[model samples]
Target: MDLTVIWAFIIAFAVFAYVVMDGFDLGIGILFPTFAAGRERDRAMNSIAPVWDGNETWLVLGGGGLFAAFPLAYAVILPATYPLIIAMLLGLVFRGVAFEYRWRDPAHQKFWDMAFTGGSFVAALAQGMTLGALLQGIEVEGRAYAGSWWDWLTPYTLLTGLGTVAGYALLGSTWLIWKLDGEEQAHARKLAIRWGAATIVLMGAVSLYNISLNADYAARWLTAPEIYWVAPVPILTGIVAISMLRAILKERNSKPFWLGIALFFLGMSGLGVTIWPYAVPEALTIWDAAAPERSQIFMLVGVALTLPLIIGYTAWAYWVFRGKVADEGYH
Candidate 1:
């Protein structure tokens, strides 16, 4: 068996889980300013309060798995995108602090709310830019990053950053539509339509820009034989996009959120199609960067034991917290 390939899938699953689970809350933070103060804002916050911290577990798993199973990829990728990584981490930290203190320090809740919005925006933008930096291909020299400090700060990266922000905002809006009712839900539906349209446009822009970054990327999606395999991703994405809009317009609450998830899943699938086997784009294949077999087998054992437990608890938590958020909230 190819342990490296197995580990790569596990890591990819973890990252995708992180993006879907945490993306909505970060999106909420991005759209916080638009929410009416007091009840509306509080309900929006409460919708995610139960699961926000728990959602980050996947991020820890993804990053840790990378360090353990693909040390060379981690080592090279980190230096190549350190600035964006640092920004993302700091944003998460500040966002967490704001989430906690906003309630505790009600007198200064405004400040905390602003902090939350800013932090979420920065984190989402940095994450998208990090993906862009990778897609554009990292500068590597014999397993080490050979890029300049500002290599990640380009127009393409900025476009991707904005796209991610828009995508997350869509997630947030759809989540709100599902979890809130009355005026807030109506407002969220409006926001969802706007953000959804923006996300689709930006998704298209990013795709077009992505192909321009490398001939291989263009060939993978547009060339014959490969195109047959790749066609389903975008085709499904269009179908889901239409379904999501219909669900939102029809006021189907939960359907929109689920369809939004489908959109993200399809987006991730497209990304996988674009960069399979390669751990660092054209620079390093999974085999080139993976750790020894014994280490992987050991890690796989632990993952097998713990992964089920993580999924069980996460599912249970969401199930327990299901239904419309209360005005009083869990806090």
Candidate 2:
């Protein structure tokens, strides 16, 4: 395989992992309020407390990989989307602090709860907006961003922000059903159905928007004769979505979260198929943005050795913490 392609897939996998893992926890925060208070809310927080930080490591890995493997793309895209990224980070800061402080001081619990939920919503929305802007296509000329800073605020991108909020809420709802019991689980089931339905609509709207705006992307992804032979990801996405919905309706506990991961993966896979070689869609190809071969070889070695360790530790942690969350959480 081409080294550039290999690097792209590596970064893509890290991102996919982050979106699926951290995505659920983030969703939990998104769905945290709606009738969740006191012990129930604490249980919701506890369910993700064990793995949330570790899950965020995947986001770091993805960004670092891009910076290392595709410096030019990182350099350009960052400046183009600096505000959204900063806002996302700020949201993350609130979330990370809320995780620790909420446990430390029960008297001020409501403040921390607000911070957590608001942070999750902001972070999810910001990230969604980033994806939206990317799909809308960045403006790059001579390997530099040439677009207005406001370019990220298009109508399509705004809808994407809303879509992701719904999507993440659905994921969180399923997780609650898995980790909690009785009434909490039932509330989550209802939330899942509502958010799941919204997500389906928003996804359709986004696809229609994508086709309406980016003719070339649409042709490559859906309309062209070769699309049948190219990527089956979008089709698989429907199956995952249906499976998750069914799992929720059937009250299948753990199945809902796993199916949520599958749904997120299939969606990311569809996006990947649409923007393969382009590190910064419509801006730079992976080849155009890659670092020197020596850097690639060195980093590839480091990545190969480290990934298994990350995976192992992550698996071990989850195994140790398996089963329903209780009042104590991990502490």
Best by lDDT: 1
Kindly list the per-residue Cα lDDT of model 1 for residues 73-158, writing each as its tens digit.
99999998998999999999999999999999999999999999999999999999999888888888977999899998899999
> With candidate 1 superimposed using the best TM-score fit, by how many Å does residue 325's alpha carbon deviate from the native?
0.6
The candidate that wins on TM-score is 1
Report the CA-based lDDT of candidate 1 relative to the real structure.
0.94
For every candidate, C-alpha RMSD to the true structure in Å: 0.8, 1.4
lDDT of 2: 0.86
Across residues 91-202, which tens digit of lDDT does each residue of candidate 2 receive? 9999989989988888998999899999999999999999998888889988888999889998988998998888888888888888889788888899988998898788
Per-candidate local distance difference test: 0.94, 0.86
| Reference-based TM-score, model 2 | 0.96
The true-structure Cα RMSD of candidate 1 reads 0.8
